[model samples]
Target: AQSVAQPEDQVNVAEGNPLTVKCTYSVSGNPYLFWYVQYPNRGLQFLLKYITGDNLVKGSYGFEAEFNKSQTSFHLKKPSALVSDSALYFCAVRDNVGSARQLTFGSGTQLTVLP
Candidate 1:
């Protein structure tokens, strides 16, 4: 079984400052991690993924995450924050060795960028 944990229910950041959303995962085999963002009444939008390559992976909208195998963590980071960046973020994980297309997602973290 695979699972993801986003400890924070909400993160508040000021516009122009850097922000980070924490995520951790657990899986039987090598994990395929992904990050997605969702807006009000919208489906999840793929942000980035860590399949097999550089530990530091960059994604849409200046977002990046580091895959730490030892810690079993993939934390999302943005150098600068924006008011429009505020949305619901999720961390998902799946077993790389399995063929299942389903992804186990975190509860979700609401990001609020104060203007």
Candidate 2:
């Protein structure tokens, strides 16, 4: 079975500073990793994905993540943080070998960007 681990329950960052939300995953076969963000009352929105590409993958809102194969980690990073970036972030993973497209999501990390 595959699973995602988000070590932090919340991440606090100052506006204009860099921000990161950690994520590590485990799976039996090759992993397809993804990141998503959720607003106060909105559904989870896809941020980016790592299907098969360069180690560094860029996504929406200036967010980017590095796919570390050895570490099995995909940590989201942003050069600068903004107040509007405060939201819940999730890391999801699924085994590419399986026919099922089910994704196992992390516990979710609430990012708080202070002005």
Candidate 3:
């Protein structure tokens, strides 16, 4: 059984400062990592993915994540946080564990930006 763990339910940060939302996962086969962002009642927007190859993967909206094979972790990071960036962030894993291919969400991490 493969799943994602988001230790924090919420993360608060000041605008213009750097921010990070942690995520860790467990998968059987080769892991396919993904990051998505959601704005109040809106659909999730694909941020990035790491299927294979690189360790450090850059993504949309100045976001990026590092794929660590040893630790089995993928933490999303942004150099600078914007007030507009305040939203629900989710880390996902796409792997063939048993059933059909599906994205297992991290229960969401709410990022609150204080101006």
Candidate 2 lDDT over residue span 1-115, tens digit each: 8999999999999999999999999998999999999999999999999999798999999999999999999999999999999999999999987687999999999999999
RMSD in order of candidates: 0.8, 0.7, 1.2
Sorted on TM-score, best first, the list reads 2, 1, 3
The candidate that achieves the highest TM-score relative to the unseen native structure: 2
Model 3, range 15-94, lDDT digits (tens) per residue? 99999899999988878999999999899999999999989999999999999999999999999999999999999998
> Could you tell me which residue pairs clash in candidate 1?
none
Which residues of candidate 1, in runs, are more than 4 Å off? none
What is the C-alpha local distance difference test score of each model? 0.96, 0.97, 0.92
Residue 74, candidate 1: Cα error in Å is 0.4
lDDT of 1 by residue, 1-115 (tens): 8899999999999999999999999999999999999999999999999999899999999999999999999999999999999999999999976778899999999999999
How many residue pairs collide in each prediction? 0, 0, 0
